[model samples]
Target chain A: MTNMNPSDKALVPFVSVDNMMKLVHHIGVEPMLRGLADYIEADFRRWELFDKTPRVASHSAEGVIELMPTSDGEVYGFKYVNGHPKNMKEGLQTVTAFGLLADVSNGYPVLLSEMTVLTALRTAATSAMVAKYLAPKGATTMAMIGNGAQSEFQSLAMKAICGVDSVRLYDVDPEATAKAALNLAGWGMNVVSCKTAEESMEGAQIITSCTADKQYATILTDNMIGAGVHINAIGGDCPGKTELHKDILARSDVFVEYPPQTRIEGEIQQMPQDFPVTEMWEVINGTAKGRTSNQQITLFDSVGFAIEDFSALRFVRDHIQNTEFFMDLDLLADPDEPRDLFGMLQRATQ
Target chain B: MTNMNPSDKALVPFVSVDNMMKLVHHIGVEPMLRGLADYIEADFRRWELFDKTPRVASHSAEGVIELMPTSDGEVYGFKYVNGHPKNMKEGLQTVTAFGLLADVSNGYPVLLSEMTVLTALRTAATSAMVAKYLAPKGATTMAMIGNGAQSEFQSLAMKAICGVDSVRLYDVDPEATAKAALNLAGWGMNVVSCKTAEESMEGAQIITSCTADKQYATILTDNMIGAGVHINAIGGDCPGKTELHKDILARSDVFVEYPPQTRIEGEIQQMPQDFPVTEMWEVINGTAKGRTSNQQITLFDSVGFAIEDFSALRFVRDHIQNTEFFMDLDLLADPDEPRDLFGMLQRATQ
Candidate 1:
């Protein structure tokens, strides 16, 4: 007789949508964002050790599906994400994602989690962590353009990780800005709802643009941007999409996630082929300079690389070690005898 | 109150291991293998319509994990598979896989199913499907070298799809050979267990070398393979792993699934960079020749491409419709308001 039962190693920890929200509230969202920033920064410091590649994308008429995979020789991770700009008209999120983490030693998935919310957290954390190094000293206010789903998370992450005291929200749609201001009402930061993008940039040392349009729309013109401000550009990630004017990209000292990817998908895609930009990891590793003078503009052009997702999955893996934040999913089949797969199926008949 | 409940679009259909075996029994395994062969053949005919790329792999000291992704401009699919030859030593399957099928329109995953067993069935079906075109006329017996987990599936697939009525099994370990022989006893095929690899090839027209060792082992020497026969070499799927000798590959008119991939992972990896081989799709589409002369040697050097996995997933997706083989998983977070993600989480707390 064979013990046709699944072992613990065969079971993967799965965090569903409900459990992800529970975990967020359990740890408090601010603390979780801060913790994720720490992990993202740690992974960035040792970025040379991890395997890196531009995300593989399958483009359709309506949207694009992408696989972002990376490994640190000990753990491997990949995120399945989709971007459908028209999804909002159909009452769906423009972007949704899920990720899995596996042990590199055996190639068995160890953690599976809904990354729609997690991606939001990690994206904001990555932006703020970069701002901490590139933003001007004594920067207290951030102009948050495009007050959509990511607006609140970006605000809180900046407040928790970058010591920002206030966020000025601006969106073409006033309802989106009102929604974000309402959501951030009791967060203790001076939340200012602005009428225009230029108004939002008033006296702000860090300007974060995260609008959700899939075309080359200049959300920030050359005249709107000033020197000494750190620009966190999050929207316009695909080939035909970008937020900043070409003049701004030419003048500012831009930093990117992965050059091969950011060259094709980030705002730099609008720039010339030989446009010079810095790799953020080099700055984190102290090989390159971040912000030399307050009069020089710095821009972090992010396209959501795989290492941030890997770090987020690693954070969830560590956080769920003792907490009841996930359920065991019988994802893999375990036969009593490894080579007896056929026999295992046959025994099930009896 | 804002509804925190997800919509129907957020639910992805999930098939578990137990359900996969049940579905196999429900549809009858032989018929499923034949159906999978049909789908594989159909996709191969339209090979130029697919978006093809070499699989993205993350390798470690122990094994490799890979993501095989493809799309037909309508439906998108990908398989997550891990090959750790050392797993069997610890009472685990050497390869375990799961796959996803998504609508290319919205980029939402429509199905997620366990593919550990499905992979074995599909790999065998693909081999036999190619042999149907390349094998000698009236070929009834196959020499199945390396009687590990994939042996029985290959035998059945060949018998069901390619009209092979008999199989001869040979392996370095007699216990593995005996296990496969016992499993195939009631499958209405002439199953022969041979002690030596050469004895298994006696009077056989199709030779399948599917040995499981990770290193290069010459399962079939130059003199062992007779002319006017078809060879399905499957196990040498990674770098530094091969089964057939270079001399055999040099003399044979080799056919490959995808040349870009086969050049690195197939038996042709033992050959030169400019080694001539026909793409199997060209043969199916009637653009190239296959098995023209009775005295000509033919080889199907299969390293398993993404299109085969795509076809298998398509077959499973079709079979699972209007059936109880799947359960809806809350995989994606869908809020009623597309941009009100924070509101959705805030309501979940209530």
Candidate 2:
């Protein structure tokens, strides 16, 4: 009666942070980012089939913990993420995440993977995918104004997915900018370190701001922006946190992942309740126009939605098959007789 | 520059199902159940300090998957559980679950454990703890209806926590009754396998009905209950599933875990909007009465709540401290410099 070994149904494929890094290098970072962008794009093309809700969040004085859940009928997925702005001072990542994918039929988790790296990858891929629809034609350079943890991922994603050949990096902390520049040195793209946000935007057709302040900070002022460039404003993600001035929102045609969520956590949170925005999925499916004119400023106010994480986990679940990148985790209990859970426990005394 | 090993901060302790059984056997099951009951009672005493919300559930044609989350300011916890009633026919556990406990201050997961077995333990402990307050004095015999997965745990908990010495088991399926009686054979108690529900209730002071049908079920009717008896009805957890008849609820003094949740998922869900019920926490904290007289029928409408799971995970987190019942999984990404996540990933190329 003593069953010491777990059966196949009891084990879930788990991709740890170490194995995730190995998988990333095994597939090459740029190509992997491109592949993730494709997956995000595919999900967006059929976004109407997904079960979408604003992520459930628990806020504290120090930080916020959130659960983002979504499903595409056949498979269900959810991500556990936390953001503590002060964690950087204590030598910890300001954001950490993990996610799971489960079968809808049996409600058993099939894959569990660390998403700290995957979140960074998926976030950048999402921005680049939206840029492919909204950026100015032949855009070759981008102004990266954060230079924090997500800076390099955003840079490489744009270069790989959007054909951006050059990147100008800037941050309030010079060391952060130096670190990002050093990391992107051999990524086959021309990297430039700039002293000021205005200097970073020079000769760039795309301006991506992703700073790390919990409060509302004006990283991009209205007067500093010019026409005919795409603005990817991702830094203003939480309430009381906005990167672009309200006047800039008034001047650009904004595109968002999900309006209900973006209204609360994106730059549009500063706008009126009736503020107009286009959903990116509509643009991907050709139901709505994207970048109608090169002279019109296209702003992608990305707060990161559940569907993106679902797509990322879906990609991991599919990619880890027949590979040594994942280990079997005994996460579920499987008894010979479903109703005899106690009998199994009793036999475990052996 | 390549770092081959994860840092101490990156690893999180994970308890698999096998480890959970080992932990349970390391400390005897009865002692662990009593320990969990104490932890749950202590949490109930401070019920006002918790941040509570109804579970977030995603329903499907086959079953339902839910995330139950709660935080008590310093520590946060959530459980992912699925209830697929049809899974029994497919030789799968009807309910499977896993849970995590995290530090609210830093938002880092501290412990991850398989909860299929722990949930059974906690649910039974909760029932018996409530019985300690509401059952008639010197209650020694219990009628155990629905001898399924939770039957053995319930019987032991009633014995360990409430001094119940005899258990009369009855199920529609005779095989289920035989299996439960077989499992409880070694325990120091009088176990009687009854052919009918009426025979199981002979001289019993406590009647626990935990049938697993997804629709409205009537395992206990109004006439089946007698004066001065404690009714623990636990299987009516989902929106449309209930175990006890509504007439029984109207006749008894009903008590519940959390009223808002119980009204939708407990036996009281069959009653009207204004039906009055007492909260069990009030009874535990001395704000309300439990069993006032020998002739009054007391019913514990158990739908299960997030706080119970939090307490259970808390107990696991405390008990597995120095034991080898857990393994550290590299679940989080710990960069030496928080802002250099890309730099850390680049160094992993070694």
Best by TM-score: 2
Winning candidate number (lDDT) = 2
Question: What's the TM-score of each model vs. the native?
Answer: 0.97, 0.99
What TM-score does each model's chain B reach against the true chain B?
0.98, 0.99
Docking quality class, candidate 1:
medium
**DockQ for all models, in order?**
0.75, 0.89
Off by over 4 Å in 1: A1-4, B1-3
Give the per-residue lDDT of model 1 (tens digit) for A6-67. Answer: 67866889898888998999988999999999999999999999999999999888889999
Query: Which residue pairs in candidate 1 collide?
Result: none
In TM-score terms, candidate 1 sits at: 0.97
lDDT string for model 2 (A1-350, tens) is 55489889999999999999989999999999999999999999999999998999989999999999999988999999999999999999899999999999989999999999999999999999999999999999999999999999999999999999999999999999999999999889999999999999999999999998999899999998999999999899998889999999999999999999999999999999799999999999999999989789999999999999999998888899999999999999999999999998999997
Model 2 Cα displacement at A135 (Å)? 0.4
Model 2 residue B147 lDDT score: 98
